[model samples]
Target: MPGVADGQGLGPVLTVPNLISFTRLLGVPLFLYLFLATDATGWAIAVLAVGGLSDWVDGFAARRLKQVSRLGELLDPLADRLYILATLIALTVKDVVPWWFTIALLGREAVMVLCLVVLRILGHGPPPVHYVGKTATAILLMGFPMMLLARFSEAARPWALPSGWALLWWGIVLYWVAAVLYFIQAGIHVRAGRAAAAGAS
Candidate 1:
């Protein structure tokens, strides 16, 4: 495993691995446009699946090709959030997924991002992706598209709704756990930073 220290000069951005992430970001608007403009839920789901697969592809390529970029890491999550948030909002407008659930999920994501941004401004880069956070994202990404499909397709309705809801609940749980872990991790780093500053003074 390559630590930040091990790869001082190696750039992770602008590589094949990161190109996949850029593709995912590009998919975000496409998915949103498809869902918003068309009644083609099946097509939307298929496109969303392609976007999701791009997520996996980028990460795998990064590891295999050693092209992991800091920008890619940030871009990947942003793309995921944009895609999921748009779909959830669209569904809510159509009276499928509840507004409350969408709000809750989006709120968590927003707060975490704000926290990371603040930390970065304070001279600490965004924290590494915790496993729990990654898992939560995967669940949410996979679940939301299915949930959207169920909203418009009767054939996908039976299992997709329940399964999507189940995945949603699990994702929520994992997100909260990850949030707690992030808080603890941030607190420790904050204290350490403060102590170091005091020592320097």
Candidate 2:
């Protein structure tokens, strides 16, 4: 979906897009249960597929239906993060991906959290999601399922393993790049805010 201008009034909450986002969020626990408790790799993959598809669908529905909301904005990214976290945990537990891989991705998220906190304390909201961040997220989402397939499906291993790693590495690099960009933007905002305060004082 195209980016709507900031401060465009957040539309209604009970919308098609929000419903789709909520459904995607609901799949997270089911995915975790399937992958970890039951070892249902195939079913887990299916759930992931649905979650990914719904991710796009929600954004499209928001734009097409003119139903974008603050809640939907919050829910959409929250669902994405939860799914990524859930997948990382499951993969790490299965030893499909190295612990360092998880740590690196998680570290970027930690930096992002710090940026958000600093900005919030300075009386600013988070910066808009960068395109690089969105691209990195989409790549990681694609890569995770391919990795699961590579581990479980002998036939897919040849293609999936190499491609999955490539995507994962690329995603990680871009994810940090986006984080740095966000951090820089946050610094600028903080300085401006403080300057305004000092001038007033």
- Highest TM-score among the candidates is held by which one? 2
Per residue, candidate 1 scores C-alpha lDDT tens digits across 39-83 of 766777888878765656777877797767776677767776776
lDDT of every model, 2 decimals: 0.77, 0.84
Q: What TM-score does model 1 achieve against the real structure?
A: 0.86
Candidate 1, residue 38: how far the Cα is off, in Å: 1.9
TM-score of each model, in listed order: 0.86, 0.88
Supply the TM-score for candidate 2: 0.88
- Which residue pairs show collisions in model 2? none
- 1-201: candidate 2 lDDT, tens digit per residue: 333434656556567788798889899999999998996889998898778666678888888877778878788888989988888988999998999999999998898888788777768987767778877887888888889999999999999999999989998999899889888877887788889999999
